[model samples]
Target: MALRLKSLTLASFLIPSNRNDWDRHLSAKHNRILIVDDHQDICASMRDILDDVGYEVVVTGNANDALEQVDLTPFDVVLLDYQMPDMNGAALLRIIKQKQKAVTAFLITAYAGSTGAQDALNIGATAVLQKPINVVELLGYLADAERA
Candidate 1:
């Protein structure tokens, strides 16, 4: 059920607020990735692609479920949709960081311009990417953590 995406063409992965600060968040053991998105299709598609790449992927369709998972498991990276019915991604990201300050998180949104990428950066997110994401570019961006 993997959907091929071309949104990478938009080049919507905004640059990190600060390169050194972003690199400070990376670590060597970054195999586990948690994806929180209201859209089940997006969750399933990302899980499929990331799973195939040897990542241990866990995905949830809402904020509550994501929080439950966060409380129980330690994830290396978290990808959250900027908007969800239960809670916006920033609030969720803040809570997740409270529980595990070491997790590298990213905000995923279709409305990047309106989603407040700076707020996400201030809340400890590594980056913000628009929807229909380029999994290849995501992998490349995350590669630093893997190689650290």
Candidate 2:
């Protein structure tokens, strides 16, 4: 919850650099977003940034909380952390899909090309975003997801 992100850890994932991106961001108000990460700092940082740009963002530190959020409200997009104590990102995405079939989800992990990370793609992730998220790339995905 401390504002320690400093555009270093989260990087472009929290900053909107392009003008066109801002225009598209207006419509992001309609998009609901969920972030699942065990790291409280990252989750809070992402939530703050995305929420500022008009997204209805919800962040959780564990799978159970993430599941509870999914049950309470439908989200248009999800960012799932690949490594967690109870369950992996792929398994969680599978369960989330069962509840929210149309949600556009991304698997976020430090290991991008690992077998487990690749396995997530088959399960139904829109993309695999490497950790220490890039805000620009994330927004691009959101824009693309919106267009789709």
Candidate 3:
């Protein structure tokens, strides 16, 4: 079965006031995440899941718009879809990495093949996920990223 991230809409959560513990779980400084996919539903779903988890989410449907947004804002992480109409995810990732060497990106796609995964990673994506995405796993990756 494929993973699906269903939770959407951000809400206030009761968190401990302890500075260290809260910082470990989350920061008042929310991480900015950019989602690049041609599918609106996929973009919205990802935004909703990450936003609810205390990330500032931005969504774009095309490579051009994604490039524009990234140029304007600094994103800590980018979620890219492998197949796109104007330009594929690999090409976009190359550009993104060139523009922001420090930004971490993950490629999301239904086509999970050795070649595809390697190509994405070779171009500097932090990881590749097979769709539909599992929210729990994504959070795990984010947690690891926070620690790194």
Candidate 4:
């Protein structure tokens, strides 16, 4: 079955917290992605786009839950929102990198020239994409990630 996750809010799942203990769950055939944003509509739009292209997508509205999901499963790429209530994209990208450095991350933000976007890029984000994303460009990024 095609994996599709939408707006997961529950907590309390456990996986290895350290990268050494975690196993890469994705295979060559599985192109899994995680979408983290506070806005449900944004997540839904991204999910629809990715799912249509046959990617396994999971989305969460909060950073903590996104972290938990990352800990549990290996994702090829992460589309992270730049601003959220609990944490910013840069901070979340740091944690995600710590968990799995191989994962490609893109910071999604309306404020492309802001400090946060620069910070995210500094911390190893693959790219910083403006909000109201262009589906063609986003898919191109995903295609690149899939190749890597």
Top candidate when judged by lDDT against the true structure: 2
TM-score of every model?
0.77, 0.82, 0.80, 0.79
- Which portions of model 1 show Cα errors greater than 4 Å? 1-30
Report lDDT per candidate.
0.75, 0.78, 0.76, 0.76
| True-vs-predicted CA distance for residue 73, candidate 4, Å | 0.9
> For candidate 2, what's the RMSD?
7.4
Query: How many pairs of residues in model 1 come into backbone collision?
Result: 0
In candidate 2, position 111 carries an lDDT of 85
The list of candidate 3 runs beyond 4 A from truth reads: 1-24
lDDT for each residue of candidate 2 in 56-82, tens digit (9 for 90 to 100): 888988888899999999988999999
Give, for candidate 1, the lowest lDDT window spanning 10 residues. 1-10
Give the winner by lDDT: 2 or 3. 2
Question: How would you encode candidate 1's per-residue C-alpha lDDT over 40-144 as one tens digit per residue?
Answer: 899998999777656789999999999999989898889999889999998999899999998877888887666465567788776677777767568755554
Candidate 4 per-residue lDDT over residues 25-129, each given as its tens digit: 122254889999999998998898777656899999989999999989988899999899899999999999999998888889988888998888888887777
Q: Which stretches of candidate 2 lie over 4 Å from their true place?
A: 1-24
Which residue segments of model 4 deviate by more than 4 Å?
A: 1-30
Best by TM-score: 2
Report the lDDT of model 1 for residue 66: 96
| Residue pair clashes in candidate 3 | none
Q: How accurate is candidate 3 locally (lDDT)?
A: 0.76
Poorest 10 consecutive residues by lDDT, candidate 4: 1-10
What are the per-model numbers of colliding residue pairs? 0, 3, 0, 0
